[model samples]
Target: MKSTGFTLETLKAKVQALTRPERFVHILRVAELAQAIAEANGLDAQRAYLAALLHDAARDLPEEELLRLAPPENDVERSHPLAVHGRAARRLAEAWGVTDAEVLDAIEGHVYGVTPDNRIGMAVYVADVSEPGRGVNAEIRELALAGRLEEAYRQAIVSKVTYLKGKGVPVHPRTLLAYDAVLA
Candidate 1:
């Protein structure tokens, strides 16, 4: 699907300029992983890569700026201001001439979680959590590489919830809903 007027290289440059050096590298890794997962799952690899590449465009934005760009829609999002970056990123992608619905949906849902109908969003979400650069265990990566995307996504969500609980951090309600939806 057509997403943006800019080429991948141009978009990469823009993302690099927008994020920290380390975050830029992580974005690249996520894109690589997303593309691999898409290929394995018979989805559009290019679209997955593009969505992953722009997924974190607003990740490093100041809290005030992020909130200004996209206000939190719930108590979970309000408590976890960074979670709103997904919405902000979607806005940024649109501003950059990305009009593809799938790509925008993926970007908007990469952080919190999307509806169960959004397979592209699930691919990006799982890739973001399981990319090599993130130090995710090999088993999770293998699951994605093996085309078991739903399993991998479910695992990632479980792990995230467990980690947050262990650290005494509040779990986002959307994450719990996603976990349930994926299980269903």
Candidate 2:
């Protein structure tokens, strides 16, 4: 993938245009936290911000539109179209000229979970779940801010699985893999 040659302002405007106001607000919050965590962890804050900004680009899109971008391959994504939003967002980002695999992976995996190897993606994942506006996972947020990325990501995945299991919601298969990876 090659650079879209997009300046930050242009990228922001494009994302803002693609997303609903509420969803865009959430994206901004995630981007802020991701950038903070990246800075704290000595990663590329600008890259993290770019990834986070695009992570939820398709979150508010209609199910049909989401499927159109990235068709469901399994029952979870088929029944819960929202599960496909991350993949759709990735495709959308690709179409919009995002060239970084880490960025694209971060955007796609933000909705489920990320590989431990993807440091930027891990930051984005933790930030997405712990960002202030969510009003939950403060400890995880603090850990990430403290540069304890491994611990923060571990806690985030555990919290997610625990919450979903408690609520009787089926955990996405990819999420299960992330959980297992953290445990391993």
Candidate 3:
């Protein structure tokens, strides 16, 4: 609702307005981690934090509306339904008067995983996977605490890919590219 002052409360409000409670917690965690990564990468930490907090604002939308709202050329056209979050998020950003191109792009690109022209997007991308509550790779905590955040991210990505493969889910090409870039 309030777009002028980007406080944590405002971020939580924005996220809660659009997502479930559990999802809101993930956004908060990602926002915290995204801010840390932004600072480390010399980016606008505030912007990254806000972007991460709202990145999944539309992730749990109904499948039909999600498909209708997404861009036809979007990378997830043929893959998992979760890919629709990007296009939905971009539209929601515009509707909410989110002005910063970098922040909006961070939300739009959070699910796609390609190289971003802005550090805010990268921060959101990295934080989306590295957040603690995902519980996808809790064991990576050791490496993460050892100052190996990037390595932890790679291992997490590997675990995600392996899980997706086992479930017969088609892994997005962009995800694989991101994993390779991080591990390389």
Candidate 4:
């Protein structure tokens, strides 16, 4: 478990610089939610906070920068460059010396989903989708906070696909794979 030199104050400044005021607020909420979920589940609360803080670090970057940092790996990402922000955030976090694989995986997997075995990743993913103020996933948030992390993750991924399909958006391959992996 490698830790980076991100003091709470410094991390706030760093993340604030990486995204808009509103987006950073969302990050804060997710970080808080993730930390709570981690504490409930006996995971590393600080690690969960760190991963959530950096999860959307590149979400507000210009599309060109996003493409440069994380080239589209599939048609879904190619069609919606915003879809690659998670991977781009991973690249940025790596550049910033975040060496923990679990943290990196959480950041990268926050946008779509993560493998079920990555407990921290699943927590971050669930938090990202269910953080308070989203007003759309209170049930999922409750599930995560109650230590039903796997169930929360399953519902989150399934809801993502459901929402995307309802909007007629193409499901990201990785999201589909995660959904299947959770079900299987």
User: Which segments of candidate 4 are over 4 A away from where they belong?
Assistant: none
lDDT of 1 by residue, 27-91 (tens): 99999989999999988998999999999999999999899989988887888899899999999
State which candidate, 2 or 3, has the greater lDDT: 2
For each candidate, what TM-score against the reference?
0.93, 0.96, 0.74, 0.96
RMSD, every candidate, angstroms: 1.4, 1.3, 3.9, 1.1
Tens-digit lDDT track of model 3 for 1-184: 2245345576567769878888878888988888877676566778878788778988878777777777556444645666778868778766666778778877887876644345567667768876788765445644544545555556656776787789987777776777677667
Worst 10 residues of 2 by lDDT: 1-10
Tell me the tens digit of each residue's lDDT in model 4 across 52-148. Answer: 9899999999999999999999899999999999999999888877899999999999987999888999999999888877888999999989989
List the candidate 1 regions with Cα displacement exceeding 4 Å. none
Model 4, position 184: C-alpha lDDT score: 99
What are the lDDT scores of the predictions, listed in order? 0.87, 0.91, 0.71, 0.91
Q: Candidate 3, which segments miss by more than 4 Å at Cα?
A: 1-11, 71-79, 138-167, 176-184
**CA lDDT, candidate 4, residue 162:** 94
Error of 4 at 58 (Å): 0.5
Each prediction's number of clashing residue pairs? 0, 0, 0, 0
